[model samples]
Target: MVFDRLIHPFCICSFSLTVSRTKSESGVPEVPVPADDTPEVLNKALSGLSSRWKNWWVRGILTPAMISFFFIIIYLGPMVLMMIVLCIQIKCFHEIITIGYSVYHSYHLPWFRTLSWYFLLCVNYFFYGETVTDYFFTLVQREEPLRILSKYHRFISFALYLTGFCMFVLSLVKKHYRLQFYMFGWTHVTLLIVVTQSHLIIHNLFEGMIWFIVPISCVICNDIMAYMFGFFFGRTPLIKLSPKKTWEGFIGGFFATIVFGILLSYVMSGYRFFVCPVEFNNDSNSFTVDCKPSELFQLQDYGLPPVLQSITGWTIVKLYPFQIHSIALSAFASIMGPFGGFFASGFKRAFKIKDFANTIPGHGGIMDRFDCQYLMATFVNVYIASFIRGPNPSKVIQQLLALRPDQQLHIFNSLKAHLTEKGLLPLLEEAA
Candidate 1:
């Protein structure tokens, strides 16, 4: 469907080129030059944009259909979202492979026929990560979600995932393509997991959507800031790969992401200081008899660690471990977000394209929009793991919850001790 829909526009543009070439060859005996093409190109783009601004005839016909789909997904919730995403993934992958084949001439995809394409999209309609099936079985068994999934067991997960991979491969065979077995095959799998996992992460892991919102807000705010600064103040080019990307825009975007990231994260995590603990707290205050460390982050009148801890009535003994996360998060945002953008620029240059796809009016493709957040999220997830564990032991999040209650409490105490040693307080303890 993607190829079919895209091909229409591409073919139209191709036809225009053909007519121009023929006219030049037959009538004028002149070849088209870059300079001569600008007027016609601008006219075409303007015409295209104007045509896309449809009248009420089209708008009225489409509005209800659009609302229906929106309501079905938004009102129906995550299950619907998963089904929609699964369908999109299959379509996007199919389009990607088809385009690759046409562009590269590596193989002729026999299964790229319209029917075969629709068949895979239909399969998604039947299978939505076994979510409905599992729910039905769980309802029958009267089990909670965690228990229900556990009942299926690790072997079940392996078998199901393996089967899905097989089907995925089978779908590609008709497209007359094989996935890049080592690199892209794994990357494809990772993307699927990441895209699908966000729903679960927002729902179950974090207990709310807010936990994941910081990264998105930070990336978007940085993008806005970059464009604003670049357009208005950019003077020095940041890189030859992206000459339009100015140092002014780059630095502006960097600081914006860091500041916004820390601020957004503080909103999500309830920390007053918009930085990780490693950075210095610039203010100082008095810790009175009524105040405690729990409210250390309930910052006011500019206070220091000692003053805030005493004010909050927290044992001045344990403020260090808690302070580092904010500092780390802020620093990482400044570094990681810009790196993500640079990576995107590199990818675009490799493809010899200015943007991934002209899907957005001012921006690029869906992937282009999300790429920075994808990088930042992965960075934060990894950083949270290593920072929480330190050198003595490496504890990933998967292991954190499995620890016995007593072990969990012990680890908490160790964290407190570590923070106290560092001369800062943990956010949770400060909040408490």
Candidate 2:
């Protein structure tokens, strides 16, 4: 009798949970399709083709168009790229939150949507504020209001977040407490995934447009090559999460992206505008992308190993050092980047959805397209920190400028003493 009582309630709970999942709507929710959308036009144009061929044509047509738009944004400058990143971040957050709402039927919950958006705003303010303080320290110090905010940025961000937390607590009802907390957690995870990665992307951009452009272009290249190879020669499945992915496509994409990255890096390394870090010109009160090229961007002769030198009949080859780094970036994009898409695929499977949204014709949602890009962004940021970046002179000078006069003099004296000990001070005096 005791065991029966325990199992009876457990069975009821399990049955109820299963029922809820069954009732959850799936497959792109009930978004009303507009008659004049690009997908519709393409569908009509290729009505005579089979569905497989139709998808191929649609994706091929839209893919290059999207690449052209991306390059155009790059030409417009870094500011435009940052803005586009923000817009895409917002859209991705919305798509994920919408999925949570539909799956949980949480739309009726008070302050759910409002709190989600509020948290997004709070997070953005914190990140962008930090970016301003880091990259535009002069501007921040010049403006009193900005200086105050920069000083108290973290405290202000915490207070804003605490306010939202209290609102969520107050909004919770007797029976809806669990559901509200679930949504709260959902919102934070989405923020971590979308907002944080996008912030790192902007950081990479400030490092140099090459850092930003090369990794992203590699991911785009791998994605395209993978699909083309799969469509023509896919036989063995790559992963259960995405049935369309195949071993053949994966290998083909890897080699293609590496070559593409190397060529692209070599070409861009020659241009100062592409290779220089983005910086604010205090005199002109504008952004500048002009600097003497670093050794990484300069062409250097690399001798081949004895075995390879004999086989190829070449002693040494000239290449930008950045091109070697591109091999690492491209390798990651081709190998590990697909895991991000696989994760998204699993998330969709859990919700029984075909796509996140119908926002992009032939592609799924903006999130669908960016799933791998976010992962790639994170890797490139880490790679730069670990292997590529050195202590930034501009940032060091900015920090020194922020110090008190006495502290600044102390640093100057300390630096002179250290250089004097190294026998470098007399050379500096001679140069002066």
Candidate that would win on lDDT: 2
- TM-score of candidate 1 on Cα atoms, chains taken together: 0.49
lDDT (Cα, tens digit) per residue for candidate 2, span 1-432? 645643686554433433243342321224222233455678789999998998899888989899999999999988889899999999999999988877656237898889999999999999998888888887888889998998899999999999999999899876566667878999999999999999999999998999999999999999999998999999999999999999999999999999999999999999998999888888999989999999999999999999999899999999999999999999999999999999999988876777888787778889999999999999999999899888867568778987999999999999999999999999999999
Estimate the TM-score of every prediction.
Answer: 0.49, 0.92
> Model 1, range 23-112, lDDT digits (tens) per residue?
221122122111222234444545545433322223334335544664566344433443554554544444333333333333333333
Clash numbers, per candidate: 32, 0
Scored by TM-score, the top model is: 2
Candidate 2 error regions (>4 Å) = 1-38, 394-405
| lDDT, residue 184, candidate 1 | 31
What clash pairs does model 2 have? none
